[model samples]
Target: MARDTGPGLARGSTARGRGATRSPGWALAVILTLICVVAGLVPGRPGTVALAVPFALLALSGRDHRTGARSGTEPLVLISTDRHLTRSTSTLRLLLTPRPKEEPTKTLAAPSLVAITLAAPGCPADGLVLQADEECPLVADIPVSGEIAVLSYGSAGVSADVVRPTDFVQAPPVRVSVLPQVGPTLARPVSRRLSGLSGSHTSRRPGEGGELRSIAPMQPGDQQRRIDWRATARRSTDQDMLMVRRTFADAEASVVLVVDRANDLPASTEDWFAAGTSTLGQGSLHVARTAAATVAASYLAAGDRVGLDDLSGTRRPLRSAAGSRQLEQIRTRLAGMSVVPRRRHRRDPVPPQGAVVIIFSAFLDEEPARLLRLWHAQGHPVIGVDCVPVLQRTESSRAQDQTVRLTLLRRRLLLEDLQTEGITVLSGSVQDEPGRQSEREHGAPLPDAAGTDLDTGLRLLARQSRRGAGLSAAPGTARGIR
Candidate 1:
């Protein structure tokens, strides 16, 4: 069965066929020259004709040169379509000039050759394949149809199409499997972890020990028992954590997602960001979605109620909480997010006080670093995920000498700058494989920590989430940028 390999994704031949026909001036100049010679040979007016003969020959010669310059000896392509079968077949053969009054014979085969076979279900029982020798010359017995499929040989990247038969219908759809990653864990503290906290302490009545006095916003390392459940429940969703001292009821933590859209970053970096925003998986939107997903997933998994504030691409922030419906809502929002240029002079709206803030971004510029400092000053435990672009240079010829050197230098400088701050930067290139070896080889350095695979980070995060440690910080702030 012949299939229509969609445009840009075809799997077969890659060369193009030759163009048809040559310039007409070559033949015309030859005929004109002959006429001038014959006129000079005539007896009547021979002297006058002789003088004109040189000029005519000169003009004819110039015309011949012009014609020859424009003429090309490329092959002619013949594409035949079987209307009944809706199949298309193309043939390529060269046309070389022959002796006078003799027919032009097909010589060389077309250079670019491609053949596609499309077969519909329950259609024809037979097919024909064409065979060619070392030199693909035109043969009188070329097979046009039969049971075997004939494919022309040529370069790896050739362009060719197979004509389908009229009786053929569209091909059937094939099933493809999408592998899943290891399931969620408790070791990683994502924004979603805050939600589960609410359910875990739901049985305890409020106002048993602490009064609802308004104090300063809560920071990391604060006691979880002091969390203002009523205020936290009202302000944020399952994706944001709420920390409070026993002294305050309305205290909340403000979380911000700072995505960097700088010129120095790699192209399609936004795509990765978008992917993370869409899901909790480790890819693009990880900055926006990962911490949020982790927090929400962890909180819900641990019975803590939490809330989420989406600052990506919105005039007004999207706010939701930790519930079955809320989780679905967060997923839907992340999935639909598109990368947008940040507006100048506008700050991301901050969540209420005591809200656990998870900042996600590539950290390509000083803006994210500055923002992290600001959030830290305000007493929020800011977890930064640095989405680093992977550099690839397979062919030395494709890159300039200076460009490659500059890239390596830039990465080093950026890593140093990120570490200077207290941010836990995870630098991973998309080009790196998902396995442990690839992660160990290309993984970014963690602050004060040894290098580890990407799976290690993810597994740790997942385990943390499953254990209700969503808000717990790693022993010391470890930063890595690969």
Candidate 2:
């Protein structure tokens, strides 16, 4: 994006200044001349008055011709990037356009030096490389990390001996959002009530598809192309009996990612009550966005429809659709989600019939649980992803530690209740500790001591679906919860 920072004249003023305002050198010259004249009158030094003449000439020569000239036009900075992947190196192209003068004689000369500053979480001070030009728009490729990058420009310095006074205007800073990196491809959560459109997953009903169902006696309406010659030869049936092959219909599944943006907490319990705590690299919202994006990409790649819904906002839900564009839309919405407090709790969004509903939330309260039960009752395969960051016990008082324990206990109980109701629960939380290098590098969950990660949790969810036959099972009847 290109932007005109602002309009202002900030001239260089020093002892050598001229025009209406006399320079400090001129004042000093006048003061010394008066002292010399006083000395000549008192000590009979006749030539002292002549010594003041050189000082007067020195002040007269320090003249400024462009006192009323305007400041140089502000340079426009344009920022463009090819991709926005998290936990990875991405290049930011910065195009610097030189200031344009509306009137050549009215404006001051261009800035002599330019300074570029790049700011982001954990960004180095010497990250920016400057190569500015007076005519052409200078382009510099900046490597950035983390979620957000802020680029700013300003005047480094200016020469005082120029014919006309000049000031370099600082460009307005530009902020670019780096999207969270997507994890490994996941098994698209199959919905029991698949849509009629042809897709990767096999439907329960027999149709012209890939997966084999069964071979049966051919009916009058059965297509001749579907005749199973091998099955007909194997079966010792009546004369002229023919067999036909049957297969399940190919159908697509709709996945709606319901994200809760009410609370964004850090991993450590110590920072919970502190204001302006740095959640760099470790935040609940970060995990939720990453998980949502990864799941959306995997499902869309498998020819499934994916949609997004924000629980804490009042905007219209993104409808389910299939394509690369759908994934981009979901990622954009997820990247923009932030903690919005005091929001009126609206009615839960209803997903398409039989769509797998995955809700990402910290689940600090009962709101998310209530929605999970609601979708479960509606015969939708619901999965609740706990997005609360992993609890880190820091050097705090005993009371604070106890409070942390109690909060964790309460969350565990809530998740258990949801699981008991046949809603699959998965942990999408990540640790913020710097020691967890693997977690930081992968941007995905690492297996715990119990060998449970996001992939393991999802595999368990698939197993549960198979055991209960998702839609065929009665609501709240599947007791084998993991």
Candidate 3:
């Protein structure tokens, strides 16, 4: 398999082999030849022999043999996308370029046209119609977007002209991460104890900044820039003593978003206890990704360092950074995260020292709650984001209903206990609406309600941050469903 990753483009290709059945045209020719032979057996049909000869020739014309591919090289089918990262939609193109042997022999020829069927979670089932053109590579535009799109080759059309040594070499799945559409710019939860020299948030200490901290008599080492001439004149009649303006210094905060990818429960309550057959975009993992992206973007926009961490321990944690590129990296990483069941315990993530930690999870397990207490103990302003979507009750078995009720009760108690420990709880639940089905099917942006709830939760957290009490400021803070 061949893979290419260029700027803004993702490409993967399949290697060719030999072992294909006769093509439809060959089957038709063979049937015709057999019919002609049978008809020629009739004493009255003398012209059938002539017809049988032509049909037999046609049937043998496209006989399969050693593939036309060179001994060392195989014909390739490549799939490319205009962009690997898309918020809504992108165009994917497939190209089939056949490499024939240099020395021609009695071997089979390369396929003139290659038909391919692609399968994805939310894509068409029918095989794509490809127009064969020897001069140009086959082109078929595939529209891919929404939540996450993983494309893989399904089946290829069989032809007698081409033979393979083995099955087609399957190319790796091409993953396109569609970053979530966020709502209005959110009020990022700033750390109470900020760091770094320069940022958007105002620090408690006085230095060079826009927001005035206090005004007092000019002291030694106070530059002329810090001196308030107006205040000096008003306070000192003869201008003997000068008054200087002191402003709070600007500092940046480090925020690490821990995303749990263990379970992805859907919003429909009835589907909670069922197998993992929930719709692709309508699950806890989607909500978690969306919330993490939204929060990371907001904080990054505020000149804060934001990082990403997966709780399932499937990948390394991204270091905190403040930039547009960092934001892109975080979103891409979030979009690529999938449910990875943890069979054994893994080491907890170690974020930057004194960094604020925000976790996005369904809170169905004790891991998130334990982490919340651990971060709080470490003096990091911790916020727990419940990514479980709004549940809608439906008719179900009594046992399943009891199980759901018991699970919810346990989750609620866990959250309440965390809140008692001064951990601010936030909701990132995606609401299940009537119009969401169309949006999911059509690759539209996610509902803004989820972002709105997150925004509100962070706003309250921000308010708490300003009051010198970050997580402890909001005890028992719960929003969304139960």
Q: What does candidate 1's lDDT look like per residue over 391-433, in tens digits?
A: 3322234344344445445545654665576544553233344
Whole-model lDDT, model 1: 0.37
Model 3: per-residue Cα lDDT over 58-116, one tens digit each: 67775542232224323235455533244323344444333333565454444445555
**Model 3 segments more than 4 A misplaced:** 1-77, 82-106, 112-115, 122-125, 128-149, 154-172, 268-279, 343-347, 391-406, 430-452, 467-482
lDDT of 2 at 115: 43
lDDT for each candidate structure: 0.37, 0.64, 0.64
Worst window of 10 by summed lDDT in candidate 3 = 473-482
Give a tens-digit lDDT track for model 2, residues 249-325.
77887889999888876766688766755435467788788888888988898788898998876567899999999
Best by TM-score: 3
Which scores greater on TM-score, model 1 or model 2? Answer: 2
| Lowest summed lDDT window (length 10), candidate 2 | 473-482
Better of 1 and 3 by lDDT: 3
Q: Which 10-residue window in model 1 sums to the lowest lDDT?
A: 157-166
Cα-based TM-score, every candidate? 0.38, 0.68, 0.69
